[model samples]
Target: MKLRLILSFFLFTTCFTAFGQEKKNAVIVEKGLIKVSVMYPYAEGKTFNMEYYETKHMPMVAGFLGANLVKYTIEKGIASGIPNQPLPFMAIGTFYVKSLSDYQAAIAPNRDGIRADFSNYTNITPVILVSEVIK
Candidate 1:
């Protein structure tokens, strides 16, 4: 239920801001890879431990998922497009996979263990975004 809501919100946001005056066909096509974004948003009084996320958490992710993960990119959000403005997210970690099945297969079995490790780094809940890359 919660995940569905989050995914729905992500979808809406992506469609709204994905391109600047570009048409649908120009932005997205049928054939592309699956991309997942794990976003940790910033709060007024909250903090994000970038060191732990990079050094410990992501390594564990790579270890458990192994070959299923095609590639990954980690972003530490700095600010909005407006200069000196704070970013909405603290960090965003993205993972790539060949297919939805591959993502499901790799994550389902290790969900609990992976989730448990969140306490080692962050207190804020993360938003997850799953999308197909544009061709």
Candidate 2:
């Protein structure tokens, strides 16, 4: 009788635990989507105007990207995982587009203007990464 009660309790707890677990919503990207990340590396003497970048530069860049741009995100670095370590990047700007060619075409004409606007925000040379979204 005791063994039966213990078994029932274990089964109840297992089922309860399983049901109580939270499910995370997954974001699925469509095929052929391209992700562009522009990372600004941190340096002692480097200067970054977050306000100008957020308010002016990104909006202008998005305008240049036009309808080709699906969405864009900007992230500011706060702290490193390791204590007392310097952050690798000061800021990161990422944009998603359906077609790489479309993105390229959109930015091609405005490339010089985009580059010219950098001095208004930061002195750091941005590292750019273009990749295909797998998931």
Go through the candidates in order and give each one's C-alpha lDDT: 0.83, 0.88
Score candidate 1 by lDDT: 0.83
Per-residue lDDT of model 2, residues 37-120, tens digit only:
999999899989999999999989888787778888899999878899999899999888888898899899899999999999
Tens digits of per-residue lDDT for model 1, 22-96:
664352324577888999988887778899999999878877667767777789988887887777899999887
**How many pairs of residues collide in each model?**
0, 0
Q: Against the hidden reference, what TM-scores do the models get?
A: 0.72, 0.76
The candidate scoring highest on lDDT is 2
Q: What is the lDDT for 114 in model 1?
A: 89
